[model samples]
Target chain A: MPDDAAGRPPVPGSDEAFRALADPTRRRILDLLADHGSLTVADLVAQFPGLVASGISKHLMALRAAGLVTAVRRGRHQVYAIDADGLGRALAPWAARYEAYWAEALTRLRAASTGTAGTDPRE
Target chain B: MPDDAAGRPPVPGSDEAFRALADPTRRRILDLLADHGSLTVADLVAQFPGLVASGISKHLMALRAAGLVTAVRRGRHQVYAIDADGLGRALAPWAARYEAYWAEALTRLRAASTGTAGTDPRE
Candidate 1:
């Protein structure tokens, strides 16, 4: 969402984001953050009964490294939240390459299918 | 897009999709297909000059395995296209969990930010 993003080279964080997304537990953590907006370590730890606080903390470290989550200290509490823009930005380059192409394809498909007797997607 | 997709268990190809997404070269190939819609093996061969068609074909095989690409035999030529829905559906389960959560967060943010002189996203 940067105002000067037009000419800027894509951030190198995409690879890290992809790597971060590989694990289910990490994905679950992101889901939790994105839903709740922000939470403390205690809040996050309570949700995962199967894993201890330290275990969740270790995964949070990886998430932070990947830029998928950000932690901020407010008084005595450290709050963690999903870096939503960071993630969407990280994947934007890859998604754009496909979506831009798909848009064009859809345009052509629409034009061709207009007068056709039978339109088949598999074709 | 299946009528029965609601009750159906998640497709097993998400892992394959994630694995396929890991490689830069394969991702590039998907970009080609996504942009152009459908291309024959020869059409795809022209795009990657450094790598021969066989090399590209190998990547395509992995893409096919990942359910990201589909091949249709048209006459003597084989046409390859990005299975857009397949890729989207494969990732939907993961994205949905986060987005559904994000929607709630946004609602809360909107309500709290309405009268505030300064809104802090990091908070």
Candidate 2:
């Protein structure tokens, strides 16, 4: 069963959005979508070797549920596209917070590595 | 069974690290650890309302497998702490790439929104 079945409401802040991104296959899908505007399921599946089409379809469903991608019917086939700025809007804030945290941590690490704790040479 | 059972080798670049972070509960756990140092499972469980202890234990295990936290046995109780600079080392690179991508996209969006597509008024 999907973890989203645990009655977690589909809020923008929900984990489902992030969880949908944790898979490498899905990340690759996003990269492909970013590079190429839209692709059919058959074309997307061809990007991954040794994986069955059914598995790719399931992964696509997860991405769709997370609002990361949209599937549209183009005649007899469905085409997938990265939802207009979907990840940029959803993940940017989350990543920005962590980026600030890590930036400070990295600066501290560099200072510690150089034995410059509490000493500002520019002073 | 865990999704990591797919025989994908545990490389730092593997999807497991990102997958481990896709959980909101785990993100909350990280936030708690950042605010307060080491905490035992019992202490951590108190932070969440209505969640069973065993479930929290499993969540911690998932975080541990992702190398996000370190658990040490203190007598009968096990205390977990955020691994020093773990996430900073792991997620910084990934998030940096995406940040650059979004920054450029945002710049473009702002330009497009302002109707400044190919005209350099500064000239």
True contacts kept of each: 0.03, 0.31
Give the TM-score of each candidate.
Answer: 0.57, 0.66
Name the weakest run of 10 consecutive residues (lDDT summed) in model 1 chain A.
A1-10
Give the top-scoring candidate (lDDT): 2
Tens digit per residue, CA lDDT, model 1, A10-120: 336676777777665676677678778899888887876666788778889888887778999989888999887666656654553444334444555456657883533
Best by DockQ: 2
Candidate 2 lDDT, tens digit per residue, A71-121? 999999899998756666666545533555456555554566475554221
Colliding residue pairs in candidate 2: none
Query: Model 2: runs farther than 4 Å from truth?
Result: A1-13, A73-76, A101-123, B1-13, B72-77, B100-123
Task: Looking at model 2 chain A, report the run of 10 residues with the lowest lDDT sum.
Answer: A1-10
**Candidate 1 chain A TM-score vs. reference chain A:** 0.66
Off by over 4 Å in 1: A1-12, A42-55, A74-77, A96-123, B1-15, B40-58, B73-78, B93-123
What fraction of the native interface does candidate 1 get right in terms of contacts? 0.03
Q: Note the Cα lDDT for every prediction shown.
A: 0.66, 0.69
Q: In candidate 2, what are the lDDT values of residues B49-118, reduced to their tens digit? A: 6576998899999888877789999999999998756666666545543565456544554456475443
